[model samples]
Target: MRTINRTDFLSGLVVAALGAAGLVEALRMPRFEARGADPFTVPGLTPGLLSAVLCVLGIVLLLRGMSGRNLTEGAQPSITQWTRASAIRTLFTIVMVLVYGTLLFGRMPFFYATALFVFVFTVGAELIDTERRLPAWKLLIGGCLLAGGAAYAIDFVFTDLFLVRLPG
Candidate 1:
């Protein structure tokens, strides 16, 4: 078993705390009983369920980390070691998500924007990954296909099945 370092302990604590906070917030959402809203359809239901799952997973992680068993084998990187490639990938993901959430999402048609974002994000991630074997043309084609399919599926689910109107 790998040694449960301070990083694992801290990560577990943070994740559990966040999950707890989310659950609390979800619980505080309006039930809408006066409007006869179905319990399953309540705004908080999904979040509450997801938060509970997170809380359970976090607790498991926390317990595992607290076990303090040391690995008898391979070397582990220190938590303080932030490689340049890792940092770049992290920053790129953050920037892409921020742009998608704050800029592209509501500014254009849902399908087009989502497709664009998915394509760019997939292509960018593949390009950034040092171990990626796909050539540029294949990457672009795969990205496009993935993006289009994902966007279409999401759009169809939300717009048709869930009956949720997406902002154009």
Candidate 2:
């Protein structure tokens, strides 16, 4: 029988590790006064929920990686996992994140920085993932919409619903 694919296994491990770590950290957060506070206004509420979701998703990924179907080329054949293109993409991602953290963070208004980050990341990811090319105009518009929607949702969740203030 074929073994699990290395990429799948590694991906699962990384995700699971991050999720577990996040869950631990989230659990350690102190509970706020709930006497007059909304139940959702607890400091750990969002983090705990997100961490749990991540853990579940990571476990699912791990199980999928262990399954013998669609993970590898075949039982006998060897397959290449990483290519130059993939390496370039990974490097690009690292650079993008670095720029976001060092340049956009604390330098611009939070929403504007988030908007740029989301738009660039989403557009790049979509372009890289799809083989069939989409029109640039469509991608640009879609990225803007996605970024705006995400920023609005996050702001509402943190500032309004959770009553947490965000840093610029």
Candidate 3:
């Protein structure tokens, strides 16, 4: 039987590695204090759950890669398919967030910087894809809505209600 595409295998491996790293980091974090000042707080609530989910996803990807099973077997991806580029795009988002936090946005207001970063990154990623083209107008609108909503929600929860400082 034909093997899975090298790109798929590499992408799965990268995701699995990141997931494993995240799992390790999460495990190393200090234990949640359940008693003091609502230790079951917002920051504590979603990350642990998300970390677990990511670990499961990583295992699944690793298994798929090892099994040599094409994730899109019925609809084989073209050699020039956009998934590879999309993977790079996702990496870009991570890098952007890291840079924003460490270099620029960490000192600024979270809502403003995050909203702009989200819009720029999302729209730029769509624009950079030479294959499987998506329309500019649609990308622009979607990016705006998504970034706006995310900023609003984050601001409402962390800034307004909880009076917590979010990374700019």
Q: Please tell me which predicted candidate would have the highest lDDT against the true structure.
A: 1
**Ordered list by lDDT, greatest first:** 1, 2, 3
Per-model TM-score versus the true fold = 0.54, 0.48, 0.43
The TM-score measured for candidate 3 stands at 0.43
**Model 1 TM-score, all chains together:** 0.54
Off by over 4 Å in 3: 1-87, 130-133
Q: Report lDDT (CA) for all predictions.
A: 0.89, 0.79, 0.72
**Residue 64 lDDT, candidate 1, scale 0-100:** 66
lDDT tens readout by residue for model 3, 1-168: 867556556666777677667766755665556545455553534665676677677667666766776665666656556677677887787888787778658776777788888888778777767763768788899999988998889888987899986774
Which stretch of 10 consecutive residues in model 2 shows the poorest summed lDDT?
71-80
Q: Show model 2 residue runs off by greater than 4 Å.
A: 1-81, 128-130
Query: 1-168, model 1: which lDDT tens digit per residue?
Result: 656666667777888988999999999999999999898899999999899889888887788668865444465536667999999998999999999999999999999999999999999999999999999999999999999999999999999999999989
lDDT of 1 at 131: 93
What value does the lDDT take at residue 135 in candidate 1? 94
Worst 10 residues of 3 by lDDT: 35-44
Report residue 121 deviation for candidate 1 (angstroms): 0.4
Model 2: per-residue Cα lDDT over 1-168, one tens digit each: 967855566667788888888888988877765466765677777888888888888878777778744733354333455677677688779988999899997798778888889999989877776463778899999899999999888977998899988767
